[model samples]
Target: MLLFVRTAEAGKYKQSPPDGIEPSTLRLTAARSNQLSYGGTSTFLSIIVQIAQYNLISPLQIPESRILVIGLDDAGKTTLTQRILQHMGQPSKTTIMSTVGLETYEFKDKIAKDKSTYKLFDLGGSGRFRSLWEVYASDATHIIIVIDSTDKGRIFVIRDEIQTMITKIKRANQKILVLANKSDLPNAVTHDKIVNACKFDGVLREFQIRGLNCSALQDTDIEAVVDFVKSK
Candidate 1:
């Protein structure tokens, strides 16, 4: 049981508890009957009292979504992430280096109508930095694979890296979005070709995977990425 004090009243003789307080407890008094009485019969007298307004407040709760951005070196992972952030109406640094370990950004998803926060984790995609990516794999709600669509010569290398990474993802609800970036380049291959090269059907047994053609440098198809994120 809790007692809440309402607004303070000055000089007035009447006593009343403000709204929201339990009315049953309003009859309780601090002084004994005899002390509050004069002579044989009891005497009632109203006094000045200061009452503060207060009410119980409930704890707040908000939901968050996590997306991990990864792929081969020079695949434009950071560029793609920043482009997505910009598309989401968030301000992101225009120039960024290849992430040595990890980079993060957050934004609100107004389209969802749930006021959900979207967090993107951009991890270095080089061979030496691949170890760091594993540490965060299990915690990600979704994965974004950025591939340089014009780098056809390294298709097998990218496939090997993707296969190795997908093998460790164990979450049933974790989804994957492969962005075939730099698709505007003259030598860029089709997104379907890149998807086939990754062999996601064979590598990912429990996760949902989809591929999209994009040119992050040109700010193209970024909405498709956000749409995929909002799907969850």
Candidate 2:
């Protein structure tokens, strides 16, 4: 849960916050909070709390992010999650599980002073569950689309899916973090090739997209992942 607490509320939020957002734009960071309750009794006392006033939520009452970690079934989405967690000193005891429908992992990147916890919604890449991507995309604040860099034949499939997805959603200002996983593999596709093939310049034109080469298993390019996620 992305909770925002202030000494005194300030700042105005948009009438409706976008499902996707850029951390730098909000300067969003989480803070450790403890819920406390106290009671006072008087001759005649009544307590009233103002939850909301004209949707003025102190620039909050907003979601930090619901990041959709999407890719093909074997695109290393699960491995990427575990590997990055290990680097963050939160190793997963259970081995990577093949996502049946969806698996969620919450992450608070360690690279920056930013304290928000990003929920990585690892949607199963199977064809059947691909449709669910749209259902979830509507609520996602950021989309981390993982690509299997070594699978040249299916790279087209991945590209087509991306093109299709972009068309089906409200993509303006959508913040996407594209990770080209398994780049350390033999004859892996180059970053340039992946971008062009994925049509990042075309269909994804309206998105605030950033791409990085990553070998999650080997921990290479891991910092880039941490940094971007914790951006702000």
Candidate 3:
């Protein structure tokens, strides 16, 4: 089975002075104290106090969001997944072979005072693995169904797979992100045609799903896909 894992590198936190504490006071204290002790004691105490204060006002961290990436074979799900990780500055070295079941990756992000985590499952795209998708389908908060935009002839086939997965999961409320991959090619099918062919009206009426054009082969286009995933 081919599985790709991308983990974001941990970011450094710049601890600011506690809300009411003056920077000048901290500087003066540091200046007066011996360099070695000041580095250890003052810094440690300041961090502890700041953390205690932050805890009192901050909300508990939300559990990481779980997402399932699924699509027809050769739809570029693995490549897209790798691109997503890269966009976050966490390029992974894991190479995905043909996935037999599923591959998992964890991502952690700290933006401002809030922390966000995500768990992504890159499910297999082979026909033999279709039966196994149902078992893991319900775990996904969001589903990304990648379609080869250039393979217009197979639109219905992709639609069938998506519908089957949705039916098995039986979660009408789960959000869906339709990635139109291979958009960089001249022969790629237009979004409108693909939607029409896939009979998206039923999905539109029943579920929360949005479509975006992407070319995972190109670095910039992958960023667009990442933004879409983050926005959802």
Q: Pick the candidate with the highest lDDT.
A: 1
Ranking under TM-score, best-scoring first? 1, 2, 3
For residues 30-101, write the lDDT of model 3, one tens digit per residue.
111111113223243321111100111212332346677788788888888887776666656466544444
> Model 2 segments beyond 4 Å from truth?
1-63, 89-91, 107-113
C-alpha lDDT score of every prediction, in listed order? 0.65, 0.62, 0.59
List model 2 lDDT by residue over 1-232, tens digit each. Answer: 2222221234322222244652223322211221212231112211111111122234353446566778887988878877666665554646666655555566665644346766656677878667656655655677888888988888878778877777776543667887889889998886678888767777677777888899977778987876665553
Inter-residue clash pairs, candidate 3: 2-97, 2-98, 2-99
Model 2: what TM-score?
Answer: 0.68
Q: What is the lDDT of residue 184 in candidate 2?
A: 91
lDDT score at residue 186, model 3, on the 0-100 scale: 90
Candidate 2, residue 22: how far the Cα is off, in Å: 22
How do the predictions measure up, each by TM-score? 0.69, 0.68, 0.66
Scored by lDDT, model 2 comes in at: 0.62
lDDT of 2 at 83: 66
For model 2 the local lDDT of residue 98 reads: 63
